[model samples]
Target: MRELRILRPIAKLEDAAVLDPVVREVHRVVDAVLKPRALEDLLHGVPAGHPMHPALVLVPAGSWIGAAVLDVVPGASRASRTLIGVGVLAAAPAIAAGWADWARSRRQQQRVGVVHAAANESAWVLYTASWLARRAGHDGFGKVLALAGFGLVGFGGYLGGHLGYRQAVGANHADAVVQRFPTGWHELGVLDDLPEEAPVRIEVAGEPLFVLRRGSRVDVLADVSTHLGEPLSDGRIDDPGHRGATITSSLGSVFEVATGEVVHGPATAPAVRFETRINGELIEVRLPRS
Candidate 1:
């Protein structure tokens, strides 16, 4: 466990070494080239509960595979090569959308994502070369390029698996509840003891909870930031309204805490709720639970 914990940071560094520069350049180009409308359209399916990348994988893979088949066959038509080229071109936008969504993630996730992007980009380059070789009537060179492109795709796919499964890039890191407290209302202390509009760090059954007192009503939330598991008590609270409040992380990811509504991505689910006893009454409030 100790070694594994240490390895996590090292792994992050390893990923960052390769992904950081690559992603920064990619993001710059993408931000400049893609219009707001097109970018919105690209990200629409992602927040709507569907992964855009998998939908994208189909086009390039299908085209490349088809091209490979045609390359081996005797007298494959010019129309078939053109169709494959078109498929490869169409796949670029889907790839861009997937990368854009991935770029906004935590540093560790971004690291793994960078390698994934590198792999895919290499595949794209190879395929583009293959298309060009075919166009120039260098069938032998084109076949070799197509095969290399396929190899790149396979390598990139492995990296994508690492990013998704090992790094948990697109996965919900917030869903894993590590702190399970006992059921029923727990005593958090006297109501007047808590300072107004200030985050009071309190431990409940060994789990940390950030309690915010607003007059007689106490608003409690998990002291941990769901994004990187940073202490939420360490975060800054801004614009505390009757309806909602925003907890801005040290890294600037804003978690909107309404009375009962959760609005944000990365931390898709609501922070856990804990019932606390204050002033001889059981008050219900939301707090992060393990």
Candidate 2:
């Protein structure tokens, strides 16, 4: 991303705060009318086991690249125009998917997403013009516009990579927890070390984890939400029930204590559940390798 590092400041730009209200208003509208959690889940790719935006982006990106290549080849003007039109058509859904993912990202990630989106939309405008130019027989001008759009798309893609790999937007937050801790059982200290029945946050193998002790059993889960790294220790735990105590994040995700599964909305991925063993007065914990 060195080639695009010049735009790194965009993530810290204070003006991106202007869209905060807009994002909230959109959230309200979606809650009021599209309260169908399934649709949101689909857009976020919960069932698909990953975010959907990345897959959708390939459409416009690939099509535009193909169009650009065609523009340079001899006797491929007509095909170039066709591919450009295809890219324009596919961009709408890809943008929608991106917006869906953005709504679930953190503030910094949202800011980066804004810049990525703006660059992409600007490239789409150029692509549209290129399509029109070719249709009107301005071959040379159309090729120029296509090349410019291609460059802009590359910039946007870099930002998109930053949002995903660097910022962890729409990623399974629990996936990182495994890497921080070892695969085998490790001592969490004696059973008396726990905070009675309350949720106690502690460090295990360099990663934060929360332990909830109830009766003779103990449930250990990652202290951070698997959704956006929201601290699970900051969340409140309800009274234990049939399914287990419901741990709800301040950012609007819920997890079950017994299995660390997300039984509510927002968090598409489940919390990282760790195996716990109590021997006499001592307790041990381990994140499963499988």
Weakest 10 consecutive residues, lDDT, candidate 2?
A: 26-35
Best TM-score among the predictions, by candidate number:
2
Model 2 agreement with the true structure over 173-222: per-residue lDDT tens digits: 77778776777888887887676678888887788888888867889898
Candidate 1: give its CA RMSD in angstroms.
Answer: 5.5
Model 1 scores worst on lDDT over the 10 consecutive residues at: 260-269
In model 1, which residue pairs have backbone atoms overlapping below 3 Å? 177-290, 178-290, 179-290, 222-288, 223-232
Candidate 2 regions with alpha-carbon error over 4 angstroms = 1-35, 132-145, 189-198, 263-268
What TM-score does candidate 2 reach? Answer: 0.79
lDDT of 2 at 268: 75
Using lDDT as the measure, the top candidate is 2
Residues 1-290, candidate 1: write the lDDT tens digits: 35456435535544456666766786677556544643543452424544466666778777777777776778884754775687679778767766655655666666666666777888788778877887888867877877887887877776677666766654534444443655555677777677877777888666787777777767776666554556667777887645477776663335665432234433333454454445464444333341
Candidates in order have lDDT scores of: 0.63, 0.81
Runs of candidate 1 exceeding 4 Å displacement: 1-46, 49-59, 62-83, 105-111, 132-140, 178-184, 259-270, 273-290
